[model samples]
Target: SSFPAVLTCKAAVAWGPGQPLVIEEVEVSPPQPMEIRVKVVSTSLCRSDLSAWETQAIFPRIFGHEASGVVESVGPGVTEFSEGDHVLTLFTGECKTCRHCTSGKSNMCQVLGLERKGVMHSDQKTRFSIKGKPIYHYCAVSSFSEYTVVHSGCAVKVSLAVPLEKICLLSCGVAAGLGAAWNVADISEGSTVVIYGLGTVGLSVAQGAKVRGASKIIGVDINPEKSEIAKTFGITHFVNPKECSESIQQVINRITDGGADYAFECIGDTGMITTALQSCCQGWGLTVTLGVPKVNPELTAHYGILLSGRTLRGSLFGGWKPKSDLPSLVDMYTKKEIQIDEYITHNISFEDINQAFTLMKEGKCLRCVIHL
Candidate 1:
């Protein structure tokens, strides 16, 4: 696959907070060394991209992180991947030199310049332009458009046999959810697991616990319809707060016999974080936080929860090391070991991006994918 030196591509632009994503024609660059220019075939909406504004990210943002595409071009020094290869982009690049990476946690790549405002790649600018004005890729891979450029480390090669449409999910929600349980918390066999917010991430956690041989998998969700697929994914107990006999915590306790051995808060809501902690039992339940709160300043609950051996922790990209985990995740998908389709409820064209965002806001779509 070859790429044009300069191409006009369709993209979603966020002018400011509380504004709708606008579709525009943005200029894309050919790949740079160790970089791969991808012709994105599919991209998915994620709350993290919307939550970036809380960090004070600049306006006119080019959002959308979970995406997949075909490698159009590779710059000098690139060898592992080539044109025509299917790949998914990771916003968090694997910087092996960083302590986080050296610690074998590539998911939390310490090299992410997320907080460095108005900064672009080493090229001094971005691969996008609007009316001759510049725009930056929201994450290293802004696949909201028809095409985008990303770092080599950010591009994870996938099984060629896997459809690019399905592989797009391995880039974000699917990876994050499974990673939280499989990598971060390490759900053990016969463990009692409780998952809050049965959206994509929460469900992924449930599947992880199931795959780990968890005997009791409890799902907690405010939406009654959320648990519709819970049992299919190995969830043994479903407690919709609306139908529960007691407080959310009590139901978890009653179901687990004392409390859950492991719990995951997939909803970034602060209130739910507290509930997630209290729902755990004595000294073994590990709670993983995979959601990004919309509120300003990273939220935290009462410090006492940390004293109960009810460990409270967070994970980025489910602690994924792109080069290693992405491929393995793709393998999992190929083998049908994990559930990715349950997350995507809708598919839209690139021009209907705002509609996708609207669906995401309404909670009508777990992942409204945009096909290029």
Candidate 2:
């Protein structure tokens, strides 16, 4: 299925940190063996995208890893898929041969990390260009533009019943939040859980808890308005950290009868990380961190929290296997148990990626999806 297509695309490129992202023309190559070229129909500019933008994670970076689209081409040895397949692009790639891959935790696969670090297919170079110069791949996904390339390991086929726009959110943020509860934290039936930072990820945590039969799902955030958003997603209680900061710990303990059984730090803030860990029950609690704090990933809390059997752990990509997890999530959405459709607060075109970032920084938008 070879055809003549120059495959030109306009993508947002951040020359460096604290600088604006400018769209530039880049040529996308056709798929090679074990690779597939996808024509991204819809992509999302998420908070994590802004994190990469702020950190200058890569030079001439093509952001927007959360995306869904049609398969344009499939390279050889790719018996798993064919052209015209509806699929979702996973930023995390798995090499199956790596230790992390064989362990059944594809999210933690080393190859996924390698691909995000600008490592491309067998050629050892990026697929997109920055003014004729090759640009690095951010998290193995660069769906900000009209098209992007990926190895077969990274492309997960999904049902066509799911809308492309909604599936776009699942690329990372949605997957991470929901995955934390279902896979990482595993909130038990009728358990008490608290989630910090009421963003999309936080809301998803609350929703996951609701589906898991959590009796009291408490949400905490500095923005009081987020309480409304949290409640809509099945949060049983909401707390304003700014107003309750002094006694937030006591308030949580009082509400949960001794703190919560599971805690999630959804916002990438250091202070909230500490609060999430300390807000757990005296013992027999789990704290799962979904936030990527800018500096000092190490967290501090009273050792007694852990000494008493409180568990503090971290997970990436929501401990999801793209193939298995993506479909189950779609089923959840179809069952109306998960509400990705109602969760979206804004929708911007690819042209407004910058404004979306600005809105995210202000903590105003729950989700700002980009239509291709």
lDDT of each: 0.78, 0.80
Candidate 2, superposed: residue stretches over 4 Å from native: 3-6, 121-123
Summarize candidate 2's per-residue lDDT along 90-163 as a digit string, tens digits: 87766667787778755666665435466574677788875578877777778887888888888788887878
Task: State candidate 1's TM-score.
Answer: 0.91
Root mean square deviation (Cα) for candidate 2: 2.0
Task: Give me the displacement of residue 298 in model 2, in angstroms.
Answer: 2.6
Model 1 lDDT per residue over 80-143, tens place: 7788988888877775677877885445666642323433455656777888787866766777
lDDT for 329 (candidate 1): 82
Report the error of model 2 at residue 208, Å: 0.6
Worst 10 residues of 1 by lDDT: 112-121
Cα displacement (angstroms), candidate 1, residue 222, comes to 1.3
Worst 10 residues of 2 by lDDT: 112-121
